[model samples]
Target: MKTNPPAVQIVAISADEAGQRIDNFLRTQLKGVPKSMIYRILRKGEVRVNKKRIKPEYKLVAGDEIRIPPVRVAERDEQTVSPKLAKVASLADAILYEDDWILVMNKPSGTAVHGGSGLSFGVIEGLRALRPEARFLELVHRLDRDTSGVLLVAKKRSALRSLHEQLREKGMQKDYLALVRGSWPSHLKVVQAPLLKNILQSGERVVRVNSEGKPSETRFKVEERYAHATLVKASPVTGRTHQIRVHTLHAGHPIAFDDRYGEQEFDRQLATTGLNRLFLHAAALTFTHPNSGEVMRMEAPLDERLKQCLKVLRQQAQ
Candidate 1:
């Protein structure tokens, strides 16, 4: 049976909890509560800060008193990852770096960053299950499920804020490696295009290059050329949904094995070389440590499958 709080509860914000948005804070406080219900209460003035209604985006400050109305919460069994599961268990070895404030993982391909949209669990969930004692863990940013490589997770709200600030200000650097069809022209180093996200009737999301879309830019540098493909380093100057994939497609070259925005023929050709997944990888990341104020650069080595594919491509080139 479910139960509702008998009376309104008031919470006093602390210094460590400050800087989070009101809606986000509510999420942590009211576990098992639906987001729609939370917003509904906020809209109806059922929730208040210092006896005054506040918007969902309001940043919590230390010493603010929040009034939460009584609400019924649905109870469900918590999701847990089995420690014996090879894939989830192997994540412990994928850690590239970890500190008190953050964790950097060499995320494997085909693993979603978070669970949703039919997935029961993902990397974050698996991590939580593995480290049952950690109080807080959240993704600082996201990567496509099929894209493998450097991923960051924040252990504290303050660290998340600091890392997000770096991302917003373009102070952090993200470098990706992609194998694309055909020889990439050396002169075509930069792709600047606007990208518009669209949802089909089937609910599948796709990004296209459109004038009315958000501004996006990707800088590409040829790393090595194969007989039928080119390995390039891609640096996204602006982050947008599928920016790199869309930009490469706009430039007449698409990533190999990218079913969404890639060349099918190119993918078919590479399949013979054992390349069955998307050929894009988040090769490296450079960012300032949230707590130490030190610049950190981390790199992830290509998995064996990717390395084998590259070897085949090199042989074909020769």
Candidate 2:
């Protein structure tokens, strides 16, 4: 006979759970519930924090009260771990920094930040599996799965809030390295374009330049010029979805190997060169430490595969 867990439940946040997002908290607590259903309940105010309805991004603090309504949860199968998640866990060597309040990682290209849409699990889920004793952990910001570099995660709710404030105030700086097709112009250093995001009929997301779009900016500086492609550093002034990628396209120099918003022929040619992924890397990040109040700068080196692609290009240039 199978019995449901309970009709209603109340939980008090502890120190371990203090810095997590409410959505993440619910996911951990209601392990068998579909993520969509959890988000749906959150949208309907079926879940509350401190007796008030809160948005999904609301971070939990110590002693906070969470109210959970009834929902059918599938029985747990404690014995199984998804292979993809296990692989992500195994790659924990990429973690760059860790402390009581935050974690910094060099997330690899092709690994999603969190599981959804189609992925089974990503860095967050992998970290959860890697550190089962951790009470709270949540991404402070996101890097596109194909963009490898310094990724931040908060261990405490206060830290997450502080970091969020930094991002909102433009105090956080992120720099990226991209290999773009064609020779980059020495004088073309800035891309100030408003970008609008659209959803295609297939439910795929695409970004384009539009007068109605939000203000976006990216600063570009040449790193190295190759015969047919250029290595450059891209610093985004305003964070928007695919801002750098789309802005690069607008500059008439689409990033090498970008499947979306890229030159298809160039991508196919790069593919033959053994460059299989988008040539975008989150090379560095700068922000004030949430706990220490000290400005911190983190960097992630280019992976061997990306380095190899550059090596090939450099050889051809020579």
Candidate 3:
């Protein structure tokens, strides 16, 4: 017979916890609780801030008091990452830079930024498992599971808030390297399109260019030219979901090996060239340091597999 935990008392929001949404904060406080239950409580006014009903999206402010309702939660064993697990352990070597404020790593392709969506664990979880002593560790931004490179993690709540603000204010500069089908016209430097995200009945997410979508823009520059493909540098001005992938697709040249918005023939051709993964990499990131206020730039080199693919493409072109 499992017993529910004692009722939670009013929690005063600290400066470190400020700026986070009520729903997200609740998720952290009420660990293992289902998101549906959290929303239900909020909708029914069972959860309140300063005795006032608040929406899930309401951001917490310093000095605010929050009241969390008691809820039944199943007692489940915490998922632990075995040190012998090669993939999770390899993250130690993937780290490009780390300090008291933030940590930057060259994330491997096929690895999700954080665990969810049927995945047991991901970069954030693995990191937390690795550093049990660290009090705060959170993702400042996210990268697609298939996209690799330059992923940032904040070690402090203040750093996370600052970095998020930079992203919102367009102060962060993110650059990607993508190998696309066909020759990218030099004159076509930018693609300004609106993107709408749609969830299929099967629960897969897809983004498309539509009039009803949010405005998006991606700047492109031809980096190298191959026989039937082109390597382009992509800088997304807007952080829309699948902005780069859909923008390149809208430009009539989808990325190589992109399972979702790519051409089957292009993937088949690249398959022979040793390109088995999406040809999109977060090559570089530039932003101001949250603590020091100094400009920081980091670059990640393409993986060996991607480099070998490029070598094969070059040989064929020659």
> Which candidate leads the pack in lDDT?
3
Candidate 1 backbone clash number: 0
Candidate 2 deviant stretches above 4 angstroms:
1-82
On residues 45-120, what C-alpha lDDT tens digit does candidate 1 reach at each position?
Answer: 8999999988777899999999999887534322342333446556766878766799899999999999887888
- lDDT tens string, model 3, 176-285? 99999999999999999999999999888999999999999999999999989999999999999889999999999999999999999988877768788999999999
Q: Could you arrange the candidates by lDDT from highest to lowest? A: 3, 1, 2
Each candidate structure's count of clashing pairs:
0, 2, 0
The Cα error of candidate 3 at residue 123, in Å, is 0.7
lDDT of 3: 0.89
RMSD each, Å: 13.2, 11.5, 13.6
List model 2 lDDT by residue over 64-175, tens digit each.
Answer: 9999998874445323645664475445667777677888999989889998878777889877766555688999999888888899999889999999999999999999
RMSD in angstroms, candidate 2? Answer: 11.5
Residue-pair clash count for candidate 3: 0
**Which regions of candidate 1 fall more than 4 Å away from where they truly are?**
1-84
**Which sequence of candidate numbers ranks them by TM-score, best first?**
3, 1, 2
CA lDDT, candidate 3, residue 56: 66
**Candidate 3 has which clashing residue pairs, if any?**
none
Candidate 2 matches the true fold with a TM-score of 0.73
